[model samples]
Target: MNRSIDIFDTTLRDGTQGEKVAFSAEDKLRIARQLDAFGINYIEGGWPGSNPRDMEFFELAADASFEHARIVAFGSTCRAGASPEEDRNLRLLVEAGTSVVCIFGKSWLLHVEKALQITAGQNLEIIRDSVGFLKQHGKEVIYDAEHFFDGYKSDPEYALSTLKAAEEAGADTVVLCDTNGGTLPHEISEIVAEVHKRVDIPVGIHAHNDCELGVANAMAAVRSGCTHVQGTVNGYGERCGNTNLCSLIPNLQLKQDYECIPDEKLEELTALSRFVSELANLNPDIRQPYVGRSAFAHKGGIHVSAVMKNEDTYEHVPPSRVGNSRRVLVSDLSGRSNISYKAEQLGIKLDKYGDNVSEIVQKLKELENKGYQFEAAEASFELLVKRMTGVWEEFFKLEGFRIIVEKNVSGSSRTEATLRIKVNDQAEHCAAEGNGPVHALDKALRKALHKFYPEISNMHLNDYKVRVLNEKDGTGADVRVLIDSAEHGKSWGTVGVSHNIIDASWQALTDSFGYYLAQKQKSIQQKEVI
Candidate 1:
């Protein structure tokens, strides 16, 4: 029989330790629901007693009926010389109303002596008492033996004693932590094997990524018979990071045939990873395994052609299995298949025997030589295709626009924008004032467009990115702007470029509204047929 492995997600606890990443109570709740939906075995929320936000999170999350995951409150073991009943943090962990409790205790003698200023025996008592108290309270206790690998190396007896204390005290799982994240994979396997021999209860592995071996070490521990893997989604944490469950879950289930996360919710992996990143206000790592933006994006001609013939030739796994899609990028390295694939995605019909593809491929190469990157600006590429194929119809025409910005000595700025636009034979002039010239321009443009197209009111910019083309001095750099907009749960992107930043933003902003309008038109036509 294959033993089950517990996937403990620390996104709320360790993932929040990432620089400038903090989830509000609402953010934590949203992530919790999503994690539960993804079939994670354990969700380790942050230390409730640490801050008001986390405290409120536990209070609100207490009523949540997680379908697959057990909510866990994380904190340190009760302080030395303190009763578990009297310790406020331990009490807070209990009162948080989670079915599971994870408490970290000092495993290294150096930490017992220096950090806690307690004797090794006193530290062991803290671990034993805390686990025993929580277990008595009918909570499944998980003792995270902090710095277990380093401590075991420093003084194997003391570290092993810590596990023995927690085990004897009734910890359901004793997790060994490489707290400093400096352990190698070989060292992890050797130490975990020894600890497995010493402990009777289930053993867990929690490796950090300071040496960038967190995932490797965690896998090695599993191979050595660890039944639980602890990590944050997307490898988020302080310093380097913890082991990444995004990579670990798939590796365990698909590669090692371990039953970690449920097989059905595997498709939610991509969305949940991105949703957590959005809640944290951090950009998702595009290169992350399974769910990353570039995980299945093909750029080279040979790779693209082969992927078109058989995706398994270039991809490790099918993207749809993880709620992601493969992308064939158009670059100088792209072949005819890449152009065809991209064209089809843009809703353009092309004959496989057509000669227009050669023209499109050559144009893509010419644009790439001119510093126009379609990989990052796919909207621009789509517009280029429409113009080349004469399939695009003009929805509105730009007459003229100008913006003025003034900065005063009082550290205040003012902007005035004016625009003239024509819809068919009708012309409209609009002006708006804003905090910045770009904002003012956007307001004026939308105000004018809303007069002719009421659907423009439903569109809002989701994200905007600006990049400089040249870094050399004394030369004006070309600016690129990518704009994301959404309406009715459908999102589309548009790109713009110019020597002026404001101009580039205006172009992208205009395209954002135009894309929505175009999509609405397509939907209406489809509805008419139905």
Candidate 2:
């Protein structure tokens, strides 16, 4: 029987050490549950006794049954000359109610001499006592040799003694940490091979990404016979980050033929990644491997054409394997095939060989030459497609609109907007005040549209981004605004462009509401069918 590799996820612990990342106790529990659902072998919650939120998380986690992963508590080893049973940190790890306890010990001689103010022998004793105490308590102990690579390079004998201490004390796993993340692949491979020769126990690799070589170094360690790999989802951690399990897991399973995560749970990878980012209130990294938005997106004409011909030409692995899909983007560099493919994706049938299609293509090129990026403005592109295909019917029309802003000397600025909209044959007038002219105008417009479509009340704008089109200093530099909105469980994005910021905002807002109504109509039609 083949032995399985362990996937130890440190997202809740090390990942929160990343800059601008903080999770509440609730957020940590939610992410922990999702990681458990993702079939990770080990889930490191955090340093339980160090923070209230982490302590709460461990208490909450103990009550729930993990489907696959074992919860682990993390902390430093017992202090020098102290019994592990009396060490506060070690006791906290045990009280966290986890099956496994991971403790870090100073492996670098410099850290022992300067940081801990202790000799190398005392550091070894700390490791031995900590691991032995934890094991005596019937808990699986993982000893993380902190700064193991740099320690080995600085004093090989001292670092080897640290591992020997843990090995002799019954540590279930001895993880070599590239703490500073400065080691290269060759150095890691050589050190891991040497450690494997010296230790009789299974070795694990915990790498950081200071040199952006964490994944490469971890993979090299596996090739050198390490059985456990530790990383955070999306490479989240302090400074640069730890290794990314998103890339590591797939590589181990598909390339190395190692069982890191269960095969049946592979499809949950992307969802798990996004879910964690959401809980952390961080935007998903678009370029992350196997689980990012741009992982399978094809933009260049040559690439899209080739991908449409044979997906393997551009993609090393199938997108579906990781719960992602291939996307063919339309842009100035796009060929007719890219546009036609995008149209098909939007459920718009266009005659690729007809005059109308050629006209739309030429118009698209002309607009792109004027600095309209269709890829980022997909909602506008969809509206254009509907118009060209004669599938869109205007339900209402805009007559005129004016916005006024007044700044008070002793108070805040006030914005009042007025709108005159024509609904069918009748005209309706509406007025509203907002914090800004755009807000006032949006409120007034939505207020008017409420007479016709009350469902617009459910729509709310989520994000807005603006980009200047040209590099010009003076007038005539067009600006673009991208708007993201959601109604119910469905979300849609729209874009607008103009020299005037308010006009661009209005265009985007109109398209957003239009898309919402379109989705509503589709849902109604589906319900009628059922």
Candidate 3:
């Protein structure tokens, strides 16, 4: 077996079928270039006949040069009664102008009988005709056997016959698809092994994630005899999802000793996953394997200690291998080791605070027991460490603050906030209006501090979330507010907890400002010392 496998990315086509997933023709081009740069073998642009947007992408991609990947247009085979020349779908595939074309044909008897309303022989004829037609146009054809797994289980002979039809018709590759995504890994391995025996051409696998086994099934197929694997980045597709190339690539290259892409390009996997998710306008799954924010994050004290000593103790592979970093998170479960690890990560010297590290752990535990979570609020945790070390200085002293919310007769609302603060014995007072109370407070505080510390103006709150600690307390429940503030391209998270939501927001808001100012001062001092 040639250990080298062909990777086909369907993110632009199948991925867009996912709910809330939308991409423009330009976005598809951008993604196609990225995939090419990563050395993917095939890029399925979209079903050109299905939409004008897909055709637009294909037309735009015509002029683009890719070093590795061949852009492929996807569509279905000719209609049962229609000849390949008269088929609009096949015509669009040719018009797509790509060197390679992929077309799916009915394999399941259920779809042939009910969906297509065609006889079994007719389905086979269309499959053969469609592949032959694309081949006649000087295009390499990849025939997708839709619902192959279920179809094989239902009628093994007929399913094998369909593969034979496409293969005999000069299809470059025949892909078996788990269209409904319900097949087991063992079944995939068995079926793929059988198909490889019956077909001389290379076998491929395209598995969906309905049963959360898409990646597993793809692995099985490869173990059997598959050389081409089809998937989407981050598993973005209809219903559950498609096989996640993000997960599969690493598993194949690092674990299974398969060559999916260039060895050096393996490290770019995490970055590519995040890039696609960003372009797709979807939040990256923090828990996703290999590419997620939390993939290598350690929170338990023992785990952190072991990982710090020997990362391989707790991690399956070095996170850096995938363009990801290992993170030591501080929470109530953290011990002195966790604090030491985190301080080292932040470049904070803890040698002077030797015994004080224990106190820091105690304080962290106490705070977390009171509805304070440091997992997402590393900025707040850093400040806590600075304060415990007696190296933090008070940036400002709050005197008083008040907020007023008024509703008008036309269902309109207005909010205003006023605040007083002392900056090095200089009393500053200011007032500002905003759409919400938190926004008003943020505006007013910046207004008061802009003169003493104009750098505060550079930072703004980008995200805010409030979680009620106890719903049993209802209106009086304690709330934990997390605020994400960004300065230029950099960002940090701060957190605060209190009985009143407004107070909680105020605490997080203040911490966010305080963290930025402190970091700015440290940076300036470092430059001065140098």
- Each prediction's TM-score versus the true structure: 0.92, 0.96, 0.97
Per-model lDDT:
0.86, 0.87, 0.94
Per-residue alpha-carbon lDDT of model 3 for 1-530, expressed as tens digits? 14899999999999999999999999999999999999899999999999889989998999899999999999999998999999999998999999999999988999999999989999999999999999999999999999999999999999999999999999999999999999999999999989988999999999999999999999999999999999999999999999999999999999988999998998999989988998998999999999999999999999998987898899999999999988889999999889999888777889887788999999999999999999999999998998889888989999999999999899999999999999999999899999999999999999999998999978989899999999999989999999999998788999999999899998899899999998899899999999
Best candidate, lDDT: 3
The TM-score obtained by model 3 is: 0.97
lDDT of 2 by residue, 49-147 (tens): 798889999998888888888999999988777888888998998888898999999889889999999887787888888888889888999889999
TM-score, predicted candidate 2 vs. hidden true structure? 0.96
Root-mean-square deviation of Cα positions for candidate 2 versus the true structure, in angstroms:
1.7
| Candidate that scores best on TM-score | 3
C-alpha RMSD in Å of predicted model 3 compared with the true structure: 1.4
lDDT leaderboard ranking: 3, 2, 1
Model 3 residue 353 CA deviation in Å: 1.1
